[model samples]
Target: MIVAVWTISAGTVMPAAADADPPFDYLKVMRAEQMWKVADGSGITVAVVDSGFKEVPGVRSESVLPGVSVMSPPINDPDKKYPAHDDVEGHGTSMTAVIVGDGTGGAPKGLAPGAKVMPVRTSLGTTMAFAAGTEGAQGIRYAADNRAKIINLSWGDYYARDKIRDAVKYAQDKGALIFTTMGNDGDANNSGNLITMIPGVLGVGALDETGEPMELSSHGPDTDLSGYGGKARIRCRENSAWCVRNGGTSYATALTSAAAALVWSAHPDWTATQVARVLIQTAGGPVDGAKRNDWVGYGVARPSKVLVDRAGEPGAPDGDPLASPAPVKAPAPSQTAAAAAAPAKAAEAGLPWQWPALGAVVAVGLGLGFMVTVKRRRG
Candidate 1:
């Protein structure tokens, strides 16, 4: 399988120009090498649900399982039963690489290289945007039925869909842990995302090196955990050795899912809720020591605290950590117009499959005291 290698780069240290090298790499900041001794996600399966996926040459993994697709009208070839391993837009491929990449070309390794990926192609945007909500629901249910322990939804939409919530419940009932982005609209628009706001899902947010929330990270009551969302390295183009792009909760969600995979792999008998509880309990990024905050929710996830240090207690194997209904927040009027303009692709506040230049994200030195982000992913 041709896999694309992606290193998440977000925050102050990342240069604005696409051509400029990022000061940090994902592996180094996360200390993936050290944690590998405890768990490498062996026997874990992470289901990636996005518009579609394509493989990049050189990036390889042991298993990129062929899973079902819920996309209608077929993309590319009508005869093809599944979305081909062809990522026309980089989103799906990048999400997969960050989770299960074999680290063939360089040091920027995936957070959980030993895990398996079950790719479930759904409409995040483009030709299939019209049915994205229904198809996404189908994808979630399908992954749960197919033995995926962790489901990663890197894409999101502003509007809530009843079908989507039903799907989330179905997966949770089947013992699957779902992770979705907290969205990228940041504080300007706290509108909740369809997938993220669903009860029992981990709505991941982005955090910089200093444990501060990223300017673009969406926040609210439902935000579950934070991850290193910064400039990440990736083979954006087949020609370039590496390209760096600033990330939001989409990258954070993917890494958090990988973290769950690592934890589950180490203790195969642990239930999904137990894994979630331990992660929330062990997370320790914020300085205030708040049990849970709106900004970073349970603080930035500290898988190393669980894996290497063997920290945290997995309480109540059968009890659900998030059983109550999530408080639904109404979106600004503008958000509706923005989403209707471009289905699937716009994703409203979701991660753009194709990242705009750093200059587009913001001018350098926004005066927020953005800390320098530095780390690299590789062996």
Candidate 2:
């Protein structure tokens, strides 16, 4: 399959215009060099717990397994099924496209093109209320119980929920690797100040082309690694045939999820902890530089490093893999200010930002701009 590649320019930060490179050459490098040749996701099932999903060409259709819908003011039809997944606001489509999209019809390619995607519509916005009472915790439980090995949570809140935490723990016990964004608020948000729990979570940070942390990529206690989450020029959902650049930790989370699939697909016997360890141990870039800043976390993740590793050979049955450790020094009090204010993509407070047209979503079969409707799919 043809995949796009993205390369980081000289420094950690690039001009906004740099996001427009065609074919995303850097992404191609990662897929060609870092990605495993084997179909590692042969038996893996990933749950993309996010907003509304429209049946699209590149994304998994039948593999887009049915789950619960918690949309508020729901879509009125309960029995209707669309031919492709519609992207109401373009957020969910971009995310899922990066995970399991086939890149057909010039659509952006996904990291794990072969894996099954179980789309669960959560809350409409960034919260866990799009679909109603089905919260993040519920999504976790559903994926775990349904034999999903990987769970991708592309949304985040400043504080962790007890219900969500417990559900994550349960998923861990059942052998699921849960990957989530560390809140896209680094260059300007208060996510770092909040207490974070690392257990049962592989918190991911955002990395740019140069393999450095984006100014807005949040960093904190639980941040394990960074991924390509930047303003990138790719296919636009408005037309789905033109180019539109986008970036954020949301994209990074999806990339990381696909990375985990690569490792897990290669070594199905490894535990979630093991898969996480390999990522950390093999992460590329400057680990020492980020040691002082909680905002950047452990720097950008380079699966290529782990892919080429001769130390812990792939498929080796040995001691605990998660035990691979890298010593770090905490940041000074002055450095903590980086966590304040708005990151690059955070919607400006009260800015008159006209939202995108909701028509494309309907065309893709999302049933948008209609009354709330929930249809129960009986087993």
Top lDDT hit: 1
Worst 10 residues of 2 by lDDT: 355-364
**Candidate 2, 215-304: lDDT as tens digits:** 566565556656776555333443243244545677777788887777777777877766766665555423223231243334445454
Superposing all C-alpha atoms, what RMSD in Å does each candidate have to the true structure? 12.4, 13.5
- Give me the overall lDDT of model 1: 0.64
In order of appearance, the predictions have TM-scores of: 0.76, 0.68
Worst 10 residues of 1 by lDDT: 354-363
Off by over 4 Å in 1: 1-21, 74-84, 234-242, 322-379
Write the residue-wise lDDT of candidate 1 on 1-379 in tens digits: 2111111223334434334555665565556788898899999999988755565543564458877677766655777554536555566676787788765553246899899888887655455566666777888899999989999987675443688788888888888988888776574545445455566778887865433467677666677777867776544543234456666777788889999999999999998888887787666523222355555666566677788778777767766564331211211223233224443322332322111111011111111122221111111
Q: CA lDDT of each candidate?
A: 0.64, 0.52
